[model samples]
Target: MTSLAEATGHALDLLLAGDAGLWQIIAISFKVSGSAILLATPPALLTAFVLAYLRFPGRRLLISLFSTLLSVPAVVVGLTLYLLLSNQGPLGDWRLLFTQSAMVMGQVVLAFPILVAMGHAALQSVDKRAWETARTLGASLLRAFFMVLREARFGLLAALLAAYGRIIAEVGASMMLGGNILDYTRNIPTAIALETSKGEFAQGIALGAILLLLAFTLNGILQHVQGKGVPST
Candidate 1:
């Protein structure tokens, strides 16, 4: 108990003292995950828009496919990318393996499906009349697109937060693709794994605390957004 207490105190000190190594890990985490989510969002949301509004053939299959992807393990994604980016693989010429770019790619894959599936759900919540009325008013398709998006903004924000939450903390994809190189591709989850494996419980505790605080803050914002513009009972 005394040792645990000591480790906890040290963890708090590291977090409070602005530890450079720790902050660097945190920065890498945000950089990779942020890039992944941003790059993935527009495409994912566009695809979701299509799936939600279009009635083309095989649409149901596509929706089901994305929904299924939501359940795929992160390790599977990491392995697949690892194979593709490895020497002798199709994309080996790019030589992206064991790099932050590869980590971003892995995370983009991990976040894409969640954004698509959840974005589709969010778009589905909008009243079809909103689209019809906008068109009826002679609003250009682009304008109507923004209008529908406006209606679904809160839910879309929720999806964004959820996707960010997932990729930010995912260890497998980052670990396999990044090799967890310190001061390079190292990130929060991978760093925590390293610290814990080495029995350096303090840093791991600090990083874990960050993840918990992040999750709580995100949930709080989501709840607030969801409640906005709604009549209070």
Candidate 2:
């Protein structure tokens, strides 16, 4: 108990002191995770809209593929991307391996499936009459899309939040692709891993506390959004 109390005290001190390395890790985490979420949003929204509105062959297969990918292990994503970005690989010339970009790419892939699946469901749940009413009123397809999006806004927000949560908390892809480099690719999860391994429990605990707080805050906001009102187009 004494050891645990001492460790907790030390971790709190590190956090309260705002350790420089800790701040760097936090910044890198936000940078890479935020970038991944931003990049994933448009395509995810588009794909969701398409799947919700369009009738075509192979749509089921595509949706199923995304659903399957959602369960794909992060390490697998890292391994696949690593091969693609590594020297002597097809994208080797870019020399993007072990960089922030590499981490972003891996995180993008990791988050894409969840965004697509959830966004699609959200769009699909939008009242079909909304689209019909918009078209009957002579709204352009783009306008109709915006209308539908408004109706599904809450669900869409949920999807985005979920994707952000996944990418921010992921370690496998970040470590494998970012190489967990200090002050660069190192994020909360990866830093926690490295620090724990090195017996730097204070840093690890501090980061863990930060990550938990972030997750709680995000989830609370999402719940508030969902609870406030239903989306109306």
TM-score of each: 0.96, 0.96
Tens-digit lDDT track for model 1 on 152-186? 89989999999999999999999999999999999
Which segments of candidate 2 are over 4 A away from where they belong?
A: 231-233
Pairs in clash, predicted candidate 1: none
Model 2 per-residue lDDT tens digits across residues 1-233 = 23657777888998899888889999999999999999989988999899988999999999999989999999999999999999978999999999999999999999999999999999988889989999999999999889889888889999999899899999999999999998878999999999888777878888899889998999999989899875465
Q: Model 1, residue 34: displacement in angstroms?
A: 0.7
Clashing pairs in 2: none
Q: Model 1: runs farther than 4 Å from truth? A: 231-233
Give the lDDT of residue 181 in candidate 1: 99
Candidate 2 achieves a global lDDT of: 0.91
Per the 3 Å backbone cut-off, how many clashing residue pairs does candidate 1 have?
A: 0
